[model samples]
Target: MDSEKELSGKTVLLMAIATGIIVANLNYIQPIEGLIADSFQVSKAAVGVVAMLTQLGYAFGLLFIVPLGDIFNRYHLIQIMLSLSILSLLLAFWAPSLIIFGVASLLVGITSVAPQIIIPYAAYLAPSLHRGKVLGNVLSGLLTGILLSRSVSGLLGSVLSWQYVYLIAAIACTILLGVLHLYLPRDPRQKQHMQYGKVMASLPKLLAKEKHLQGSAINGFCLFGVSNVLWSTLAFYLAHQYHFGSGVAGLLGLLGITGVLFASIIGQMVDKYSPRMTVGLGILFSTLSFVIFTSLGHLFIGLIVGIVLLDLGTQFGQVSNQAIVQSLSLQASSRNNSIFMFSYFLGGSLGTFFGTLAWSNFGWSGVCLVGTIFLVLALLGHLFLKEPEKLQKVS
Candidate 1:
């Protein structure tokens, strides 16, 4: 495989599809928690544990597994991860107990870091001028999978057993693994010589040294936490307020396509302008979205409009932050991405925990209040944080 081979449109499209499929594994359980609870005769709070465990696993993978991309052949690494995903999905499909299913969910989450690898790989493949656009397109696939997986899961759960969802995903993963094995070129870069322990040691050093990386990680943490608060409890809110089931609740994701639509445009903006400027605009849009939801979430039309702004705003903020973070070091893009995502998903885990607690105690309003707090913190952090002129001295 020629590392110098220019990326084609077809290659980009394949990366996008592969990313979507891999990411969907992390989210396919979200909308169908009710179904799983019913099957296991458990409380909704207990079902929330499933999602929490999955997120925890993802964070762990980001910290531990993604750094390997900087050292090993990424193509082989992806194949290994996809194969693990298939095994985990099979376990999820056939688990005899909720405990078994929960464990499988964790494994699925761990292996689902394939997209994290793919995103940076795409960045490497693309020319520097088009890097933002390429990353945005790939991330659009990622976000679409995160949002739409809910709908697909809900529909599958409605039409068949919830277990069937995992079963089907296993089959899909198998096919994707084959496609990737055939289509992906061998990674051409020489493997890094850093020992694994040294690699792990550098994460904290990087965070302490790179002020921009620190700020972006914190921003990612808060914004993702806010987003998770909404997604984690959306189904329960709809079910309680509107007498809707998982299927109807899941349909809200379709409205969230506003994010997908704006991703490439946001990428172009990143290329033409500063990431900081785009991030500021995104924060304003997201903050306005919360204002709408807080005041008018009870109204169905209001929910739709709020979701559109919320999705668009979050994607704008997220993509720009990524563009900046990925620029820190070309050689360490994978490691840099890992640190950022580890923080990002760590926030997600916290949000899921508290979001479920909020749902149990105070319901929709509580969820909104908590989510608002996260976003406000993110906005303030971005405003106050200063990027250092040269991180090389500290590094």
Candidate 2:
């Protein structure tokens, strides 16, 4: 552990950028599915295997790997995981067939759990007053990476080759790996000496012990699921309803920059206000976004309006939710984060499934309704949780 307890701006910036770069690997294939399909002479839908496998791999790692942050030297774990991610990208870059690419993508997702470790580690380094603010900054970088990945991938696929994106990402990851190794401070907390099995077994206990964590995790799941419902089929909706190309569909990610900006501000708000209030405010925006999409999304302007609302609302809720969870147990921050993110992405997978079904059966209208239903459930779940009456006395 580093003797220094306070975080530096330079450290925060590196953490933020590293998180963004790591997470971008998961999204890089999304906008280039068509090019990948063309390369392998497969249907566009088949090319989705890379993205799906990557997500599944991430879920697996969250369940199995991220908890190690609680037990091992996190700095060592981070370096090992990031190096593995770089190798995965290299494999993906040279993949000759869809099958090999899918495998490599899965490895990339698994290794990308490095950021989950990084986030909690950052939380540990900050003062309680600024934890949310620091997390917000990191999440903004993550959001930028996710959004820009689609734009960059689309442009590269059009002008060069989709494989070039993976190659470039590999190079970027290598640079980030070296930087992180050279600069990141060691965790100040003493490492847990728990066995691997004990570490894995502790997750259920963590969930059972923390009602707030459960509430936040459930809320996160529903919110992320709602976002995925719209995102998974956005290109299809653009093509069918607006006669737009994939390039245009990719640009919708830029609308999410609104969310990125809000993430940092919302963190400050969470510290000044209550997490419950912030979450409620975010839910209002989410509900409004769905209402607009349902009634007026046929217009380009309406779709844009819906995109901004959804992204902003989701970020507000997410930042607040994460703040609440990270505050639960400092000793178990990584495990708590793992459970939270696992549920979050599981919700995403569910959303993708139901969104595909809704789009197939009822078109964009169904998508809107499904997303609304998710928000409603999330709101209700949040409402049912016991508010922290103690927090009222903090200030």
Winner by TM-score = 1
Taking all chains together, each candidate's TM-score versus the true structure is: 0.95, 0.93
Query: What would the per-residue lDDT of candidate 2 be over residues 1-395, giving only the tens digit for each residue?
Result: 33135578888888889888998888787666656777899865565545667777887888899999999999899999999999999999999988999899889888888989999888888777788888899888877888887777767776787898999999999999889889998766665778889878889999999888888888888888898778777766886887765677678878999988888898888878788888887788888988988888999999999989988888887888888888887788899999998887777767766776677678898888899889988988888974342222110
Error of 2 at 149 (Å): 1.6
lDDT of 1: 0.84
* TM-score of model 2 vs. true structure: 0.93
Q: Model 1, range 139-209, lDDT digits (tens) per residue?
A: 89888887878888877887899999999999998999999999985676776788889888999998887
TM-score computed on alpha carbons, candidate 1? 0.95
Q: Where in model 1 is the C-alpha error above 4 Å? A: 1-4, 386-395
Model 1, backbone clash pairs (residues 3+ apart or across chains), number: 0
How far in Å is the alpha carbon of 110 misplaced in model 2? 1.3
Q: What's the lDDT for candidate 2?
A: 0.82
